[model samples]
Target: MPLSHNPNLLQPRVPILNWIADMGSDISDEIRYRLCATLASSTLPALLGSLNSFCITLLAYARLQNTILLYIALCDLIFGVMRVCATNVSWLRTVAADLVVVSGIGWATMMAATMVVVGFSDDTPMLIIVVASGLGSCAGIIARNYAAPRLALAQVIVIDASFKIPFCIHHPEFIPLILLQGAGFIGVAIWIMRQQRETTVRAIAGQIESRTQSLQDPLTGLLNRRGFAEKAQSMRQTSSTKALLYLDLDGFKQVNDRFGHGVGDEILRQAARRLSICLPNASICRMGGDEFIVLADCHSRQEAAVIGARIIQTISLPTVTSAGQASVGVSIGISLFDPMEVDLERAMVEADEALYRAKRAGRGCALLHDPAMSGASKAMA
Candidate 1:
């Protein structure tokens, strides 16, 4: 199948609903989902960010009798509550939202504390404590959220600036030294983030590629049986009608035996191409060997008949490949299905049985499954 027809790529995914997506349009949904899953599943990072900030802010509020510190402490408590609720409700989806909001609250706590120390000019122990905490938060963002590079970089910049701005303002003589050290810190953070993001993206992409391969028929580039089942699982509709066509290429063995397997493989690929053209909106599958299956929306037996006959005509021509030349006829059995009465398995089996009838009647036609047809024919006999 062409890459354009591959459904697995660029499909819209609900951010895992309760545990799904977290990235923006800049990032792919698959990457977003995996990162969300990783962040949500881990409790230590979020727990540390919330508890550490809350306890420190609450402590400063109680000791200084500062009303601003109390509000910051409450904001920290709210972030902690959000993290806890996300973890308890879903093990994978809320951290990205929590990270943004919590990072802001943390910066406010640090900045307010720094402003208080600067105003007093007392050079109390609180200034040292505030600076230490701000540095820790910046480091934590870089280390814990590296996979989400943009968020980490933005948070680090804001949180680091909160307390740094106060120090830069107070002592003009120390500006040069502080700027040099800050540049070095940023450079190292960028280097670390780049390395980690590359590794994480590669890992997630490999897993997705592996999964797509498993559900695929590598030879014809069509969905395999399992792949068909997976797609059908998503299409179950009680109110809608669908037709399942079980198809087999007649004289395939003769071509394989005479011209060799190379020509046979080319013939199969050509047949798949023709099916794709005939049923542009249908789910087509190569069920191993020369057998293939298709499921398409069908409103009536007449529609099923038309589809089955069209599939036969579309692939009726002799195929000429670089390997060799061969001609093969097709046999198709169609079964109409609706999710209300029966499931996919039963529909598949009915289609197979119809194909059996088509082959028995002579191998170049289409047949719709009708149990009563067999009984009526027996009565005539």
Candidate 2:
């Protein structure tokens, strides 16, 4: 084709390509999908740009009757139609990711450069139009594909070659001036793109870090109460029945008073570690201070009781830390209910009631709350 004249090609001045590429894919499959997506982003821009090029090249060919111009027009029609149609089809984007997307960008960059090179030899009026469109195409290429610096720079080089080599040969006296202008243009574009990428990366990364911190307990490396509630919302949609375990550490305050807060903090960390070990397939959270909660798929009272006993026994052992040796016990209250039917708040209330019953029965025991028991039933651990 001649050269793209789409004004909207310049609209995407932001360094979107660099930002998308920086959000790296941890999985192998994602890399291809990301590349395909990036290619898809240029669909509208390329389509519009190609239309201008296609129309002008046809006009130029009609007037000059040049075989090269005719060939360029054909290339524009085929490349433009194929890219626009393939991208719009979802399966084609993923299935033929490497073949289509990589080749598409290759075809596009090559075609743009070819137009810039051939169009320079036209008459004065057509040359002016070609020159203007070529500059616009170069800017669009640099702005949109800045994510891949190699590709962006390669495109700029090709375009600069098309313009510089032809103009320098024709006007031997202006070669020095042309070279200076081209070099300065490329250097400035590179600097601006690098700065834009850094600023965008910092802004997005900071937001993600802040959100992650809000949902975590800094002390025990477990979910906080708010985080637990947020997690439970997803559980409510599942079909399985689950149990809520409300735990309170016994003799924690006495250990803190005797050994200072350092040893107490160590004890708390050990407690969290023990809970994770006991309930490996469960969501665990440190409620506050010595209280904690667990959500797991528990079917019956006997299974819940066995789990509670294991937890109490593990937590009761002496935990030796750098500060000192500290010993503590735990009381567990388990309530089984359908998460979808009863909800987390109501289930937690029942677990809390059962927790008080466990404390009353013995400091190191488990209790299952039932309306019929009236706080009479307890599992001595």
TM-score leader: 1
For each candidate in turn, the TM-score is 0.79, 0.70
Report lDDT per candidate.
0.70, 0.70
Worst 10 residues of 1 by lDDT: 3-12
- Regions more than 4 Å wrong, model 2: 1-93, 96-100, 103-107, 110-114, 117-120, 137-144, 158-162, 165-187, 235-237, 276-281, 297-310, 337-342, 368-381
Q: Give the TM-score of candidate 2.
A: 0.70
Would you list the clashing residue pairs of candidate 2?
A: none
Best by lDDT: 1
Global local distance difference test of model 1: 0.70
Candidate 2 C-alpha lDDT tens digits along 77-114: 77777666554554443333232333344445545554
